[model samples]
Target: MKTASRWAIHVVPGLNSFAYGRIAIQGDAAHAMTPYNGSGVNQAIEDAYVLGRMLTHPKTTMETVESALKAYDSVRRERAQGVQELSLQLGRLATFTEDLQLQPGADPIAVTAARLEAAGIWVGEGDLEDDVRKAEENFTKFIAKA
Candidate 1:
């Protein structure tokens, strides 16, 4: 008897914004992902890096920590969510039989492989320096206002 494996990716909107009232969640606590593209660990690391930098900066203080967390949240939420969506899309591409069966193509597997390759760009290509700069800029503005 052949059994099918159950694989799923559940996404929650705005999961990276796990800070509130001096409390913040990081790593897997902030966002969860399936091990589709092996991005879960990397994302968690990124989250920790962002949160750690904000909370440990010399300019950050107890009074202004909230602003830093908010800036981290603002920067991380969209990027993390984008990764989640891409992971889901990659899963769909890997198991694209349902849609392909309906409309038989000359090479369904090839098409799926191409789609997967295209989607992998997001997973593999990201500018961490640029992201950090933007987050710092946002945090600076937040601090200035506070």
Candidate 2:
């Protein structure tokens, strides 16, 4: 096996929104997280999915692109940031980092295992269709107000 001389993990602070005006950021650019839960790519894909839906809506136009981007931000920001935080917490738990506080009588190994299971469940427990629908609704409302 080839050994590399250096390794680094870079993460960005979570943001409240991923879009500003017509320019929207997705993937690692928006929410960078630790690799503990292996969710970075998944979250990026989700961002793309929602943004794609918003931008492709029949009613979307140059005049309303900003609203589409805002709708994308509204639907994706909270969920992506949540995954970012969960990924960070999983990293802490996996490494038994001091960031996690064990309750009295709590078994460290068991706790980590439980958290891992929950993360797996949570990662798989959302409806992409529902998310797209919500983004569409938000885009429509925003366009109406413009």
Candidate 3:
């Protein structure tokens, strides 16, 4: 085997997960992982929240329910992974004690400030309910192909 220069491993803590749509899968049965930033548990909890909402909705069809679940995946995945990536990026700076990688809209601050500012913009976009609803409507009408 070729020798690799670096290796990293993650230890996933136990947990439960659930989703809605004509069906529900719960607990570690749905998702299982330990994030370096301790976000895994919170994300799993969000699943529990939306899953319950989906279950209680009368308009919930296998299709609609599935759609909601897909929405949840899109939203939650972005939120959780975004934070996780930020934390990992931060760890890199802390470990290296160097300047941040400059990219789009990047400024000349130290790595930590740049990272936090970028993270703020990533997270500061608000009115999530309205945003998702607008996005879904747009997808259904304009963007989606039959």
Candidate 4:
């Protein structure tokens, strides 16, 4: 086996805030993470899609843009933060640590594999359609009361 010379690892903590106003943040601007599970770009794309749907819906208007943005925040913030946290967890599992090395009866390789599989399941399974529908419905209801 070839010996590795050097390895570097970095993990970013999950961010809970991703919304402000019409000036919405997405991508790395919203949640930055190590390139472990490829969640940054995927979440950004999902953000764009959801924002687009919210903005273009017939119920949304200039007067209601703030309401739409609030809807986006309601729908996307928790889910995006979840993905960010999972990415951080995967990053921690990938990097070698003294604790991992010293743990009795622990198989680092197997643990890593299991963590990765769980992350894959989480990142792969999402109901974007349902999220968008809820955003639209909530926004409509929010504005109806205004």
Best by TM-score: 2
- Model 1 TM: 0.80
Residue-level lDDT of model 3, residues 1-146, one tens digit each, is: 58888666553322222234435553334544433344456556665665555445565454565555554444454454555565566556556655555677865456566565666575455455653554355334422332
Please estimate how well model 4 matches the true structure, expressed as its whole-model Cα lDDT: 0.77
Every candidate's lDDT: 0.75, 0.88, 0.50, 0.77
1-146: candidate 2 lDDT, tens digit per residue: 49898779898797867888879999999998888889999999999989888889998899999999999998898998889888888878877883447899998788778878998899889998999998888988999999
Model 4 residue 2 CA deviation (Å) reads: 25
Error of 2 at 17 (Å): 1.8
TM-score of each candidate structure, all chains considered together:
0.80, 0.90, 0.49, 0.78
- Evaluate residue 43 in candidate 1 and report its C-alpha lDDT on the 0 to 100 scale: 89
Model 2 poorest 10 in a row by lDDT: 92-101
23 in model 4: Cα distance from truth in Å? 2.3
Model 2, residue 54: what's the lDDT?
A: 88
- The collision pairs in model 3 are 15-28, 16-27, 16-28, 17-26, 17-27
Per the 3 Å backbone cut-off, how many clashing residue pairs does candidate 2 have?
A: 0
lDDT (10s digit) by residue, model 4, range 1-146: 49988777553455555556556777777766667678788888889999899888887788888788878878888887788777767767777542345368878787778768978998899789999999888898878876
User: Candidate 4 regions off by >4 Å?
Assistant: 1-16, 98-106
Global fold similarity of model 4 (TM-score) = 0.78
Q: Which of the two, 1 or 3, has more TM-score?
A: 1
